[model samples]
Target: MTPRISALLAGLLVLTACSAGSTPAPSPTSSPAASPTAVQPASGPAITISGMTFTSPSAVAPGATITVTNSDSVEHSVTADTGNAFDVEVDGKGTATFTAPTQPGTYPYHCTYHPSMHGQLIVG
Candidate 1:
Protein backbone atom coordinates (compact mmCIF):
# COMPACT_ATOMS: atom_id res chain seq x y z
CA MET A 1 0.00 0.00 0.00
CA THR A 2 1.03 3.65 -0.46
CA PRO A 3 2.45 5.63 2.47
CA ARG A 4 -0.79 7.70 2.88
CA ILE A 5 -2.99 4.57 2.76
CA SER A 6 -0.81 2.81 5.35
CA ALA A 7 -1.06 5.76 7.76
CA LEU A 8 -4.87 5.95 7.34
CA LEU A 9 -5.25 2.20 8.05
CA ALA A 10 -3.05 2.47 11.15
CA GLY A 11 -5.13 5.37 12.46
CA LEU A 12 -8.36 3.46 11.88
CA LEU A 13 -7.00 0.42 13.71
CA VAL A 14 -5.93 2.55 16.68
CA LEU A 15 -9.35 4.22 16.89
CA THR A 16 -11.13 0.85 16.75
CA ALA A 17 -8.91 -0.61 19.47
CA CYS A 18 -9.46 2.40 21.77
CA SER A 19 -13.26 2.30 21.39
CA ALA A 20 -13.36 -1.46 21.99
CA GLY A 21 -11.25 -1.14 25.16
CA SER A 22 -13.19 1.84 26.59
CA THR A 23 -16.21 1.38 28.83
CA PRO A 24 -19.53 3.02 27.95
CA ALA A 25 -20.73 5.63 30.43
CA PRO A 26 -23.71 4.87 32.61
CA SER A 27 -27.07 6.00 31.26
CA PRO A 28 -29.28 8.57 33.00
CA THR A 29 -32.12 7.05 34.96
CA SER A 30 -35.28 8.45 36.56
CA SER A 31 -34.09 7.62 40.09
CA PRO A 32 -31.07 6.15 41.78
CA ALA A 33 -31.18 3.40 44.39
CA ALA A 34 -30.99 4.55 48.01
CA SER A 35 -27.87 3.84 50.02
CA PRO A 36 -27.99 1.11 52.63
CA THR A 37 -27.88 3.55 55.58
CA ALA A 38 -30.37 6.09 54.21
CA VAL A 39 -32.99 6.91 56.82
CA GLN A 40 -36.75 7.08 56.27
CA PRO A 41 -39.34 9.36 57.91
CA ALA A 42 -40.60 8.29 61.31
CA SER A 43 -41.29 9.66 64.76
CA GLY A 44 -37.59 10.13 65.45
CA PRO A 45 -35.29 9.73 62.51
CA ALA A 46 -31.53 9.52 62.71
CA ILE A 47 -28.79 10.19 60.15
CA THR A 48 -25.16 9.20 60.12
CA ILE A 49 -22.30 11.35 58.85
CA SER A 50 -19.28 9.56 57.47
CA GLY A 51 -16.63 11.01 55.20
CA MET A 52 -18.38 14.39 55.39
CA THR A 53 -21.60 13.06 53.95
CA PHE A 54 -25.09 13.24 55.43
CA THR A 55 -26.27 9.67 54.98
CA SER A 56 -30.04 10.17 54.84
CA PRO A 57 -32.86 11.34 52.65
CA SER A 58 -33.05 15.10 52.07
CA ALA A 59 -36.69 15.39 53.04
CA VAL A 60 -38.30 14.91 56.41
CA ALA A 61 -41.43 15.95 58.29
CA PRO A 62 -41.64 18.73 60.85
CA GLY A 63 -41.35 18.24 64.64
CA ALA A 64 -39.15 15.20 64.32
CA THR A 65 -36.18 14.38 66.47
CA ILE A 66 -33.49 14.43 63.81
CA THR A 67 -30.41 12.80 65.17
CA VAL A 68 -26.97 13.32 63.68
CA THR A 69 -24.15 10.91 64.34
CA ASN A 70 -20.68 11.89 63.25
CA SER A 71 -18.37 8.99 62.56
CA ASP A 72 -15.53 11.01 61.07
CA SER A 73 -12.21 11.79 62.67
CA VAL A 74 -12.87 15.52 62.50
CA GLU A 75 -15.65 17.60 64.02
CA HIS A 76 -18.62 18.49 61.84
CA SER A 77 -21.79 20.50 62.19
CA VAL A 78 -25.20 20.79 60.58
CA THR A 79 -26.24 24.40 60.97
CA ALA A 80 -29.33 25.72 59.26
CA ASP A 81 -28.84 28.59 56.88
CA THR A 82 -32.30 29.96 57.62
CA GLY A 83 -32.41 32.15 60.72
CA ASN A 84 -30.52 29.62 62.83
CA ALA A 85 -33.65 27.62 63.31
CA PHE A 86 -31.81 24.39 63.98
CA ASP A 87 -28.11 23.97 64.56
CA VAL A 88 -26.41 20.89 65.88
CA GLU A 89 -22.83 19.74 66.19
CA VAL A 90 -21.30 16.34 66.74
CA ASP A 91 -17.75 15.79 67.83
CA GLY A 92 -15.56 13.16 66.23
CA LYS A 93 -17.18 9.79 66.78
CA GLY A 94 -19.97 11.44 68.73
CA THR A 95 -23.72 11.94 68.28
CA ALA A 96 -26.14 14.85 68.67
CA THR A 97 -29.87 15.42 68.19
CA PHE A 98 -31.95 18.43 67.22
CA THR A 99 -35.62 19.05 66.61
CA ALA A 100 -36.72 19.76 63.07
CA PRO A 101 -38.38 23.04 62.26
CA THR A 102 -42.09 23.40 62.90
CA GLN A 103 -42.59 25.32 59.70
CA PRO A 104 -42.89 23.73 56.26
CA GLY A 105 -39.99 24.92 54.18
CA THR A 106 -36.55 23.94 52.95
CA TYR A 107 -33.66 24.52 55.31
CA PRO A 108 -30.23 24.53 53.74
CA TYR A 109 -27.55 23.30 56.14
CA HIS A 110 -23.78 23.14 56.02
CA CYS A 111 -20.80 22.38 58.16
CA THR A 112 -19.39 25.49 59.78
CA TYR A 113 -15.84 24.13 59.71
CA HIS A 114 -15.94 22.73 56.19
CA PRO A 115 -18.08 24.84 53.89
CA SER A 116 -17.97 22.20 51.16
CA MET A 117 -20.04 19.85 53.30
CA HIS A 118 -23.69 20.85 52.82
CA GLY A 119 -27.17 19.48 52.24
CA GLN A 120 -30.79 20.60 52.35
CA LEU A 121 -33.36 19.67 54.95
CA ILE A 122 -36.82 19.75 53.37
CA VAL A 123 -39.54 20.02 55.99
CA GLY A 124 -43.03 19.37 54.70
Candidate 2:
Protein backbone atom coordinates (compact mmCIF):
# COMPACT_ATOMS: atom_id res chain seq x y z
CA MET A 1 0.00 0.00 0.00
CA THR A 2 1.13 3.56 -0.56
CA PRO A 3 2.71 5.36 2.43
CA ARG A 4 -0.02 8.04 2.37
CA ILE A 5 -2.85 5.50 2.30
CA SER A 6 -1.24 3.44 5.08
CA ALA A 7 -0.85 6.54 7.33
CA LEU A 8 -4.52 7.47 6.76
CA LEU A 9 -5.67 3.94 7.66
CA ALA A 10 -3.56 3.93 10.84
CA GLY A 11 -5.00 7.28 11.93
CA LEU A 12 -8.54 6.05 11.35
CA LEU A 13 -7.92 2.88 13.36
CA VAL A 14 -6.49 4.89 16.27
CA LEU A 15 -9.52 7.22 16.28
CA THR A 16 -11.98 4.27 16.23
CA ALA A 17 -10.19 2.56 19.13
CA CYS A 18 -10.15 5.74 21.25
CA SER A 19 -13.86 6.37 20.70
CA ALA A 20 -14.80 2.74 21.45
CA GLY A 21 -12.98 2.77 24.82
CA SER A 22 -14.70 5.99 25.97
CA THR A 23 -17.17 5.55 28.89
CA PRO A 24 -20.80 6.51 28.45
CA ALA A 25 -22.07 9.48 30.40
CA PRO A 26 -24.21 8.84 33.46
CA SER A 27 -27.94 9.70 33.47
CA PRO A 28 -29.64 12.00 35.99
CA THR A 29 -31.58 9.11 37.52
CA SER A 30 -28.39 7.19 38.25
CA SER A 31 -27.79 9.23 41.44
CA PRO A 32 -28.41 7.77 44.90
CA ALA A 33 -31.88 7.96 46.51
CA ALA A 34 -32.75 10.98 48.66
CA SER A 35 -32.41 10.45 52.42
CA PRO A 36 -35.50 10.33 54.67
CA THR A 37 -36.34 13.38 56.81
CA ALA A 38 -36.74 11.35 60.04
CA VAL A 39 -35.19 8.09 61.15
CA GLN A 40 -37.07 4.83 60.78
CA PRO A 41 -37.57 1.93 63.16
CA ALA A 42 -35.22 -0.65 61.62
CA SER A 43 -33.74 0.34 58.29
CA GLY A 44 -33.96 4.10 58.74
CA PRO A 45 -31.64 6.45 60.60
CA ALA A 46 -32.00 7.03 64.39
CA ILE A 47 -32.12 9.94 66.80
CA THR A 48 -29.83 9.45 69.77
CA ILE A 49 -31.21 10.60 73.14
CA SER A 50 -28.78 9.80 75.89
CA GLY A 51 -26.80 11.39 78.67
CA MET A 52 -26.88 15.18 78.27
CA THR A 53 -26.47 15.04 74.52
CA PHE A 54 -29.46 14.83 72.18
CA THR A 55 -28.65 13.83 68.63
CA SER A 56 -30.55 13.45 65.40
CA PRO A 57 -33.59 15.49 64.36
CA SER A 58 -34.39 17.61 67.40
CA ALA A 59 -37.59 18.74 65.79
CA VAL A 60 -40.06 16.88 63.64
CA ALA A 61 -43.36 17.46 61.91
CA PRO A 62 -46.62 17.09 63.78
CA GLY A 63 -48.12 13.59 63.75
CA ALA A 64 -44.78 12.23 62.70
CA THR A 65 -43.50 9.26 64.66
CA ILE A 66 -39.99 9.85 65.96
CA THR A 67 -37.77 7.00 67.02
CA VAL A 68 -35.46 7.80 69.87
CA THR A 69 -32.66 5.29 70.46
CA ASN A 70 -30.63 5.27 73.63
CA SER A 71 -27.06 4.46 72.79
CA ASP A 72 -25.84 5.25 76.28
CA SER A 73 -25.02 2.57 78.88
CA VAL A 74 -28.08 3.39 81.03
CA GLU A 75 -31.85 3.62 80.81
CA HIS A 76 -33.57 6.80 79.59
CA SER A 77 -37.10 8.13 79.60
CA VAL A 78 -38.77 10.50 77.09
CA THR A 79 -41.49 12.63 78.68
CA ALA A 80 -43.31 15.58 77.18
CA ASP A 81 -43.97 18.62 79.28
CA THR A 82 -47.64 18.51 78.30
CA GLY A 83 -49.63 15.31 78.00
CA ASN A 84 -47.93 11.98 77.46
CA ALA A 85 -46.83 12.20 73.90
CA PHE A 86 -44.86 9.04 74.56
CA ASP A 87 -43.22 7.87 77.75
CA VAL A 88 -41.04 4.80 77.54
CA GLU A 89 -37.96 3.66 79.44
CA VAL A 90 -35.38 2.31 77.06
CA ASP A 91 -32.46 0.29 78.30
CA GLY A 92 -28.97 0.79 77.04
CA LYS A 93 -28.77 0.30 73.29
CA GLY A 94 -32.57 0.12 73.20
CA THR A 95 -35.03 2.33 71.32
CA ALA A 96 -38.36 4.10 71.95
CA THR A 97 -40.94 5.26 69.43
CA PHE A 98 -43.45 8.08 69.85
CA THR A 99 -45.74 10.12 67.61
CA ALA A 100 -45.75 13.89 67.65
CA PRO A 101 -48.86 15.78 68.58
CA THR A 102 -51.47 16.32 65.87
CA GLN A 103 -51.51 20.02 66.66
CA PRO A 104 -48.66 22.20 65.57
CA GLY A 105 -46.89 23.57 68.61
CA THR A 106 -43.68 23.48 70.54
CA TYR A 107 -43.36 20.59 72.98
CA PRO A 108 -40.43 20.43 75.36
CA TYR A 109 -39.29 16.99 76.50
CA HIS A 110 -36.63 15.70 78.83
CA CYS A 111 -35.19 12.46 80.09
CA THR A 112 -36.53 11.42 83.46
CA TYR A 113 -33.24 9.84 84.40
CA HIS A 114 -31.25 12.87 83.30
CA PRO A 115 -32.94 16.16 84.03
CA SER A 116 -30.33 18.06 82.10
CA MET A 117 -31.00 15.98 78.99
CA HIS A 118 -33.67 18.07 77.30
CA GLY A 119 -34.94 18.73 73.75
CA GLN A 120 -37.77 20.45 71.99
CA LEU A 121 -40.16 19.08 69.39
CA ILE A 122 -41.78 21.61 67.09
CA VAL A 123 -44.70 20.28 65.12
CA GLY A 124 -46.07 22.34 62.29
Predictions in order: lDDT: 0.83, 0.74
Model 1 misplaced regions, further than 4 Å:
1-43
TM-score of each: 0.61, 0.58
lDDT of 1 at 118: 83
For model 2, the stretches where C-alpha displacement exceeds 4 angstroms are 1-46, 56-58
lDDT, candidate 1, 43-74, per-residue tens: 45777889888776567788878888899989
lDDT of 2 by residue, 1-124 (tens): 9999999999999999999989987676753445445455364334686555677564567787778788888888777866877576777888778777788878787778888887777777
Q: Pick the candidate with the highest lDDT.
A: 1
Q: Cα RMSD (Å) between model 2 and the true structure?
A: 6.1
Clashing pairs in 2: none
Per-prediction tally of clashes: 0, 0
